[model samples]
Target: MTSGPECPLLFLDVDGPLIPFGSSSGHPQDSASDTWTSADQGNPLLTRLDPELGPRLIALGCQLVWATTWMEEANEVVSPRIGLPRLPVVEWPASSTAEGPRGLHWKTRAIVEWADDRPFIWVDDEISAIDRLWVDASHPGPSLLHRVDPGKGITDADFSAFDDWLRLVIPR
Candidate 1:
């Protein structure tokens, strides 16, 4: 994932951030059921993705990158469903063994490396204090590790926060 100097990078996670894991009604509040039939798809969770989010995310003017276990499949399976283009996907390092400080997410180091000192935001459900501390100390540029609720995914409040941060960091 090469740095785009013009816009801050937004490392997006798919499972919990895009597809809310569990809801009180047992389905996402903004479920894509009307647009997509989950019966045919191998992964039912994909149905939880709201198509409206794509335009909202694009409106933020950040360079969005996939940072999920979904990998390239995020492009093949999730992109069209959410009206997103084929953005760059972060490739996770092999060897599942944890390499960084305890409580640091496996994707944290790779994501920071991908940013390469550029200002960036990581939107995921699993971001932890340790990950935040590590990034604060190691990453030279500005960064925001915004953790989403797995049960609710991203809400209007999250978008508002993103808009607020992007305005300060990129300045239009």
Candidate 2:
């Protein structure tokens, strides 16, 4: 919420970006309770996150907003699953979808108003061109939308791309 005005923002996510696409399950309280993520490889979601990426990236000085379908489940489910601290979550809008909307991931509209004016990175699996255009046109400097490929875990290749973005594009 506070990420809009002057500070840089990182709208983080869980199910798709952090835990790998389709790698997470429903809330523990939900009737469709399932444990996401394969026990084999853990999760390659945050190769260069706050604690792991070290302070250099943290010195980028950005606020991380958990912009995912995880919603409240971010606390009940994702926190323990990924070993991340209790990060703030952005609630998806109350819209409708035909096939795969309500059950697991909800389409997020709140991100528009919540993004504010800060530089932001939207890391999600469901991001579309329309979403990218919306944020690119409206938000502040260094705003970007990164699509993490499903099934394939976040590899070094992905971080390499991010590094380019930070260095060449943003260059902060």
Candidate 3:
């Protein structure tokens, strides 16, 4: 809830980071076809979300913001399921595809703009080397562009990386 400049921003993407699309062993994507019902509102993918993630993310002590195509819908559909309260959603640019360089992810520029020179972390599966280069050149503050495996989702390793980076950017 704290979005002050002193707090580092954590721009979270819902798909690959929260819902693993890889193997059928650990993720819900395996039984999606058989288990989906009207109660799911047709989004079987929602079942892949880990309810335990909210507390883990909050413990990182950063301002969490939705940075997915789900937009504000992330607050309604994804939040409660993961125990997160309503969070600030990143508003993507209207011509996202048209603005960035070739191979650059569309969300890259807007995410940098949103951070506004404050330290930030962008977690998404779609991030590319081009996006990292762009952020390094354009963003003035510290940043970590962590790409998650869509097949595996966010792992404990990812949290460890976050902790490592936060230790450097945030004072204890």
Best by TM-score: 3
Backbone collisions counted per model? 0, 3, 1
lDDT, residue 12, candidate 3? 98
Residues 1-172 of candidate 1: C-alpha lDDT, one tens digit per residue: 2335857899999888889987645443334446544432666667677878999988888899999998987887788888899999998989656588888899999999999978999999999999999999999999999999999988899999998998888776
TM-score of 2: 0.61
What is the lDDT for 75 in model 3?
86
* lDDT of each residue in 73-149, candidate 2, tens digit only: 66555554444556678866566452333343344346655765546666677777766665666555666677777
Task: Please provide, for model 3 over 86-114, each residue's C-alpha lDDT reduced to its tens digit, 9 standing for 90 to 100.
Answer: 99999998886756678988888889988
Per-residue error at 100 for model 3, in Å?
A: 3.1
lDDT of model number 1 = 0.85
Worst 10 residues of 2 by lDDT: 24-33
Ranking by lDDT: 3, 1, 2
* Model 1 stretches astray by more than 4 angstroms: 1-3, 24-40
